[model samples]
Target chain A: MVSNIEWTTKEREVAQEIFDRAYERETGALVEEIRDKASLIAKLEDVWQLHDYLSAKRHNIDGKYDFRDAYLVFVFSQLVKEGWVELNELEDLSQDKLKKISALTRM
Target chain B: MVSNIEWTTKEREVAQEIFDRAYERETGALVEEIRDKASLIAKLEDVWQLHDYLSAKRHNIDGKYDFRDAYLVFVFSQLVKEGWVELNELEDLSQDKLKKISALTRM
Candidate 1:
């Protein structure tokens, strides 16, 4: 089992904001795709892709959101690697955590 | 494991038509749904729903489409029950299979 993250109140709020921003961006892009019409098979592909993405994101975000401090840095790094949460957005986090996240994203 | 379906060429053709029709109709409805834009959450819900539905249909149709004679009756019955196929459309199939399929659909 993974260890629980040690989170300060301010850090928790920042994490929440970062998570929300990433979600909003992801869903916003999906909505735009939905608005575009395509062939039936192509449309099915989009739906399936979106379904997979959202389902996966749901499972990933499910346990991570409740202030699991240990997982937060990795989570932020993952979001950063995907271009969702920038390092600047996570500036409020501790330098130690930010450095690790940055290193992981680079790798 | 299920038994192999005994299929005559005529019956196989009928099965193919039914399968194609069902696929076309199912995908048609989904495509229509795709064209209608909803809220982000609602759109995500639709995308997930479509994803799950298409995934299931693919698995179900995978082996069923091979004209396995034993499974054909049940397959047709299922399609009939779902309103994707009509009894008259399957008239080319043997009465033995048709009666069984019709009974299963009623059940």
Candidate 2:
């Protein structure tokens, strides 16, 4: 297991701010309109999920950007700029798929 | 603001199991190798960030996938199946972009 690097309180706060602002700018609405702050913070935590996987993969490389940081700076920023899809829609989609899969299993 | 639909405890547990198994199957290693459970849970929270945005966009569409669910089922599943790009590499790429942007700003 690669050693985990926890995001400092300051880092988390900053990242959250960036995420919120970008999200608002692109969608033209505040994040709180649909979800609460606690919920948003919870989701932001996933940014670190892939950190260990990436760190191990890039262990041999020099001067790498921290996985968590890169996700915020690049992938996420792009997602915000492009506008993100909604959670309810995604859940509905999942239900649909689950039903289809269930039907197939019963057949 | 669209009505928020929170994931139930059961839903969260089920989603995590699916995410973890899919991740391990594709990476040939468990997620715990690099990050802890708490961290992984945090990241998964983000699947909901775009929900409001997507619902508003697709509000008129009949029989559409929820953004969050679609992300898990389609986008995330594809990422796992395709062998996700290492987070570090994405970070490195981001750093390169940042450096270039910084340089341009300074010029």
Candidate 3:
């Protein structure tokens, strides 16, 4: 269920950069949301609400950043779908990988 | 080994209250810490530092709050050791439980 396309050394570096940038962009938004929520947490119960939110967000982001070569297509697709990555940023990747990521993003 | 002493209805209520209050106190401190750190988190990596801290704290607090009657003595000992629960607050438990918790806290 994963893409097994071969990647060159340059493609690997490009993929990693794209992934890091996407992670930084998305997590920056999450931290902003957390800062706002944390400031409003006046009660013990309100703290649990923030805890639950961060738990879920951490799980989602952890899954998204699974950077195994076999999973990069799926990862990139999710980043694109979430607006954390643009199509042109992935141009350094093989056309095969890009096509797969594009197809998955649409799905 | 755990305490097998039976809990009377009143004892159970007292136990729950002490446990909850201890939890509220400890987590209140944690929330305050998070608020301060979150305000100062200026970079993506700083957010991950908070993320790691929360993950570890959640694991620790979750383990401490298992709340089964069989495990309450051990739980109370930990609470006491951490200064979240005082010995006098546990007076409602049986002498056997109180003694065990008191002894464990010293360890």
Q: A1-107, model 1: which lDDT tens digit per residue?
A: 22344678987888888888887776666555544422223566665564465557556655544446667777777778878777898888888677788888987
Candidate 2 structure quality by residue, lDDT tens digits, B1-107:
11232445665465555555544453333222222332232332332423332233234221222236323333332443345422222232234332432333333
Residue by residue across B40-107, what tens digits does model 3's lDDT show? Answer: 86665776677678778888998998678888888999999999999999987888888999999989
Q: Which 10 residues in a row give candidate 3 chain B its minimum summed lDDT?
A: B41-50
Which structure among the candidates has the greatest lDDT? 3
State how far residue B23 of model 2 sits from its true place (Å).
47
Per-residue CA lDDT of candidate 2, range A1-107, in tens? 11232445665565565555544443333222223222333322332333332233234221222236333333332343345422222232234332332333333
DockQ of each: 0.27, 0.01, 0.39
Candidate 2 — which residues are off by over 4 angstroms?
A: A1-5, A29-74, A77-107, B1-107
TM-score of chain B of each: 0.68, 0.28, 0.89
- Distance from true location, Cα of B93 in model 2, Å: 69
Runs in model 3 deviating more than 4 A are: A1-17, A65-74, A90-104, B66-68, B91-97
The regions of model 1 sitting more than 4 angstroms off are A1-6, A34-66, B1-10, B33-66
Clashes of each: 6, 18, 0
Best-to-worst ranking by lDDT? 3, 1, 2
C-alpha lDDT of candidate 2 relative to the true structure: 0.35
* Cand. 3 TM to true fold: 0.70
Docking class of 3: acceptable
Per-residue lDDT tens digits of candidate 3, residues A34-55? Answer: 7777777677567667767777
